[model samples]
Target: MLRAYQFRLYPNKEQQSYFANYFGSVRFIYNQMLADKIDHYKKTGKMLKNTPAQYKEEFLFLKDVDSLALANAQLNLEKAYKNFFREKSVGFPKFKTKHKSKASYTTNNQSGNIRIEDGKIKLPKIGFVTIKQHRDFDGVIKSCTISMNKAGKYFISILVEQETPEWLPAEHKIGIDLGLSDFAITTNDSDESVKYANPKCLDRSEKKIKKAQRALSRKQKRSKNQEKARLVLAKK
Candidate 1:
C-alpha cells in the first residue's frame, strides 16, 4: 500500500519567485497536453496514450521555451495525466492560480531529504524551507503530499506502508438500533437506559441560525445590506 504525507514549506522572496516559475511551467505543460489531446483526437478519432516516455519526448520541446526547472515541472503533468487515464480520476491538469491552495506542483524526490531538520528542509529552487514538525511516524515513507487547508494552515501528509492485524473475535457480538429520540438499543438489553448528550446547546444555536436566516431573507440580493445579513448567517 502507498500513502502520502504533506508538509509546509516556508520559502523566502527569492524562493517564492522560483516556485512561481516552476508552477507556471507546470501549468503551461498541463494546458499544452490538454490541447494536444484534443487536437490528436480530432484528427485521429482516438484519445492519446499517456506514457512516461511519451511525455518525456513532449517535454523535450519545452527546451526552447523553458530551462531545466521548467522542464522538470512537466514530470508532475505527466503523472497527472497518467492518473487521469489509468484511474479515471476527475479534474484534469489545469493552470494554477497566483494565490492557489498548497501543492503548486510536484516533482521527483531526488534529494532523499524529506524530513525537517534544524527547523527546515531543503527544496529545489527554494533553499531550506521552515516548518513546524507535527506528529512523527515510524515507517518507510512512500510519498509526500503537501497541501493547505481552508483555514490557511500548511500540512505535510507522509504516506507509508504499514501492516495492520485484523481482529476476528466472535465472543462479543451485539445488534444495535439507533434513532433520533433514542441513541441506540442493544439486542441483549432491550430496556437499557440510552446515553444522551443534552441538546440545549444545539437548540440554542439552531434558534440563532434561524433568526439570522430570516433576517437575510428580508434583504435584497446583491445589496450591501444583503451581504451583511449573509455574514451574520454564516457566523451563526
Candidate 2:
C-alpha cells in the first residue's frame, strides 16, 4: 500500500530563495516538456521516445540555463506527465506563479533524500523542515512534494510504500437516523442521545447577516456610507 504524509516547512532566507527559483525552473521545464510532447504527438501521432541518458543530459543542461541543482527533477516531471495522461488530475502540469495561493515544488525519489527523523524532515534544496509527526511511518519514502496553501502556510507531502492491514468480513450491519435535537436513533435502541446541537448558532448568524444586508441596501450606492455599510456587512 502507498500513502502520503504531509508536513510543514520552515526554510531560511537563502533556502527560500533557492526553492522559489527551483520551483519556477521546474515549472518552465514542465511547460517545455508539455509543448515538446504535443509537438511530438502532432508529428508522429504517437508518444516521443527518450532514453534515461537523454533525460540525464537534459537535467544537466539546467547548470547553463539557471542556478541550483535540478537532478532527478525530470523523473518527477515525467511521472507527472504520466499521471496527467492517465487522467489522475484535471489538467497537465503548468507554470507556477509567485503571487498564487499555492506555490511550491516537488522532488523525485532519486538525487535527494526525503528523510524523516524525530518529527522533522530533510528535503533537497530546502533543508530541515519540522512537522507534527502524528504516527510512525514504517515504509520506504518514495517522493516529496512541497506546496503552500491559501492560508499562506507551507507543507511537505511525503509518499511512502508499505503493507496495509487486511480488513475483516462484516458480521452484521445496522442503520441509524440522525436528528437535530437528538444525535441518533438506533433500530434496536428506544432511547435517543443528545450528542449534537440543533444548529441554533447558524440560524442566529444568518439572521444577523440578513439584517446587515438590509441595512446596507438602504444606503445609496457610490456613497461613503454605502461603502462603510458594505464593509460592515462583509465583516458579518
Candidate 3:
C-alpha cells in the first residue's frame, strides 16, 4: 500500500529563498513543455520530445534548484499530454502560471539521499529542513512533494510504500446507494437493506456558516481581518 504523511516545514530565510526558486523553476519547465508539446501536436500531431536537460543550457538558473524537481515536471507534462490523447474526459495540458498554480515540486528518493536525520528532513540540493512530524510513519519513504499554501505555510508530503497482507474477498457482495435524503443505503445478497441517516453537519450549521461568510465578505479585501475570516469560513 502507498501512504502519504504530511509534515509542516519551518525553513529559515535562506531555505525559503531556495524553495521559491524551486517552485518557479518547476512552473517554468512545466509551462515551457506544455507550450512546446501543443505546438508539436499542431505541427505533427505528436507529442514533443523535449527534456529538461535542454533547458539547463539556456536557463542556467535552473541549476540552482533541485534537478529532480525539474525532471518530475517533465514527467508530469508528459503524463498530462498522454492523458489528453488517451482519455476523452480530460482536456489538453495547460500552461502553469506562478500566480494561480499550486506552488509545489516533487523529488524522488534514491539511495536514501532524502530522509529525516537529526530532527530534520533532507531535500535534494537544499540541506536539512526542520519539519514537524506530528505523527510517525514506519514505512519506506518513496518520494516527497514540497508545497506552499496561499497563506505562506510550507508543508512536505512524504509518500511511503508499505507491505500489507493480502485480504480474502468477502463471501457476499453488498450494493450501496447514496443520496441527500439518506446518507447511504445498503443491500446484501439476501435482499436485506439498511439505511443510514444523514449526519447533517453542514445542514445544521447552515445559518451560522452563512452569517460568518457574510461578515467575511464585508471585510476589506486582503486585510488581516479578512484573512482570518477566510480561515474561519474554511474551517466551517
Question: Between which residue pairs do clashes occur in model 3?
Answer: none
Flag the better candidate by TM-score, 1 or 3. 3
Top TM-score: which candidate number? 3
Q: Residue by residue across 42-111, what tens digits does model 3's lDDT show?
A: 9998767999988888999987877889999999988888897899689878888876799999999989
Worst 10-residue lDDT window for candidate 3 reads 227-236
For candidate 2, the 10 contiguous residues with the lowest summed lDDT are 63-72
Where does candidate 2 stray beyond 4 Å?
Answer: 40-46, 50-102, 110-112, 168-194, 198-236
Which wins on TM-score, candidate 2 or candidate 3?
A: 3
Using lDDT as the yardstick, the better of models 1 and 2 is 2
What is the Cα-based lDDT of residue 232 in candidate 1? 77
Listed per model in order, the count of residue pairs whose N, CA or C atoms clash below 3 Å is 13, 0, 0
Put the candidates in lDDT order, highest first: 3, 2, 1
Highest lDDT, which number? Answer: 3
Model 1: CA > 4 A from native:
6-14, 46-103, 148-153, 163-236
C-alpha displacement of 229 in model 1, angstroms? 14
Residue lDDT tens for model 1, 1-236: 45555556665676556555555555666666667776887899787754333454656644433234344455666677668767775666665554453445544344464445688765544557677656565655544544444333445555666666486777755677776775565664345554544457788999998998899899998899987887677666
Task: Give me the overall lDDT of model 1.
Answer: 0.59
